[model samples]
Target: MSSRRSGISEEEINELISKLQSLLPETRRRGSGRASASKLLKETCKYIQSLHQEVDDLSDRLSDLMSTMDNGSAQAEIVRSLLRSS
Candidate 1:
């Protein structure tokens, strides 16, 4: 099939766009086919960044909880060393 964007076939591009649209919230996605590729890409970037931030927050919370556990686990031991060294 002839490509509309050089190298990448138009079908492939459309498929990628559809996936991107699915990732975005309904409020952000322009369902009318009027959204540009750049706009879609920008939204996807923001969405990914937000997800990364969420993951980081959850990881920090998990670390804090693990370190506070009284089970004498490996993670608690590591945290104990850091606290004593301070």
Candidate 2:
């Protein structure tokens, strides 16, 4: 898939992998057993997909909030104009 504004950067992916490695048991960290390449790739893809969804959701929410604030401000201005006329 093409990279988007919400896409994870290499640095972020590396950080995530580092954190995951830290959480692994000492034996696993020492390479007694390792996750398969396919499994790791699948997990990473899932994580990135989740991040994209979260970013999109937050963006939509922020847009809605801004629209609400703008409407409120417009209404307040109308009310102030009416009070001045009275």
Candidate 3:
């Protein structure tokens, strides 16, 4: 997709909105009615905490990969400089 808002056709947005609206009611019903609000909140909080940790782990891995790339680029530049000096 182009990096322009104008490039986003209405049909695509309507399709996405339709899918989201269809899913929302089912997801909302998961903790409704017989379930106590407190219990539902506690479960949701725990699930979000777990997801947060997973995201943190992935962020750390991405940081390591970026650092490795930066180091490799520096090494390549040094090699190129040495070659030019010779």
Candidate 4:
């Protein structure tokens, strides 16, 4: 598949991978690094999950606000029409 079709450029993917790798805990000894890396990965996963929830919440709130605005606009138009008739 081409990068254009994939919706993500190669550079962006690589950059994201690099960022995830950087989140891994660093150690001088290779044998003891696994525990730290695992813990860091878990933390990163939790953070990402929280971010997803936040985005969902924001989206819902924005939808509600837009709906409210539309209703208000319709009500205002009705009021204006009633005034003009009177």
Candidate 5:
């Protein structure tokens, strides 16, 4: 039940690989052709990186929107004070 690669059983390795493959949508699309663990790991790294970038982009956009809204409210308050004095 031991594999030469790492003294781990084949079943254990296959179970781990299946878990990894399930995380990847592209791998599921390949249908019958299996991806090596190395490729799957690489794809996972890229997928994680893309998600990280997306989160950063969204956060920046949200901050920008909040800043704009704050400024707009301040301007409105300034105009109200001016109208009251006149």
Candidate 6:
């Protein structure tokens, strides 16, 4: 194949292979070194947990404002009315 591609003789291919081998060490098979599904899932779960906590915190703050509205404060009711209309 090499002989036809570069017009080199079969003898040249053998010589080239030997020369390359002499100059470089033999290559070894590599390990996968890939992340496991559990590792990925744990990271994803952590990210989702942070987002969920943020949403919960925001909901709690909104709930506090909503609770204040029930006390019949005129300014709070106005804000609540505006929020409902929007």
Compare the candidates by lDDT and give the number of the best one: 5
lDDT of 5 by residue, 35-65 (tens): 8889888999998899999999987985675
C-alpha lDDT (0 to 100) for residue 5 of candidate 3: 58
Candidate 2, lDDT over the whole model: 0.63
lDDT of 2 at 75: 68
Clashing pairs in 2: none
- Compared to the true structure, candidate 3 yields what TM-score? 0.41
Tens digit of lDDT per residue, candidate 6, span 8-84? 88778666644433332221122233334454446556766888999999879988877766657887878778779
Lowest lDDT sum, 10 consecutive residues, model 3, at 31-40
TM-score of every candidate: 0.64, 0.45, 0.41, 0.44, 0.64, 0.37
Could you tell me how far off, in angstroms, the CA of residue 71 lies in candidate 1 after the best superposition?
Answer: 2.4
Candidate 5 has what TM-score? 0.64
Which wins on lDDT, candidate 1 or candidate 6?
1
Off by over 4 Å in 1: 1-6, 26-34, 72-86
Candidates ranked, most accurate by lDDT first = 5, 1, 4, 2, 6, 3
RMSD vs true structure, all candidates: 7.8, 13.2, 13.6, 12.8, 11.0, 19.4
Better of 4 and 5 by lDDT: 5
lDDT of each: 0.77, 0.63, 0.59, 0.64, 0.79, 0.61
For candidate 2, the per-residue lDDT at 25 reads 49
lDDT string for model 1 (3-85, tens) is 85379877788888877777788524456564678888897789889999999998799677875797668868887687679
lDDT of 3 by residue, 20-74 (tens): 4333443356533333445545655676788899999987985675566655597
- Which parts of model 2 are misplaced by more than 4 Å? 1-33, 71-86
Per-residue lDDT of candidate 4, residues 1-86 (tens digit) = 98789899988966665566565434222333334445556767887788899999987985675566655597656755765796
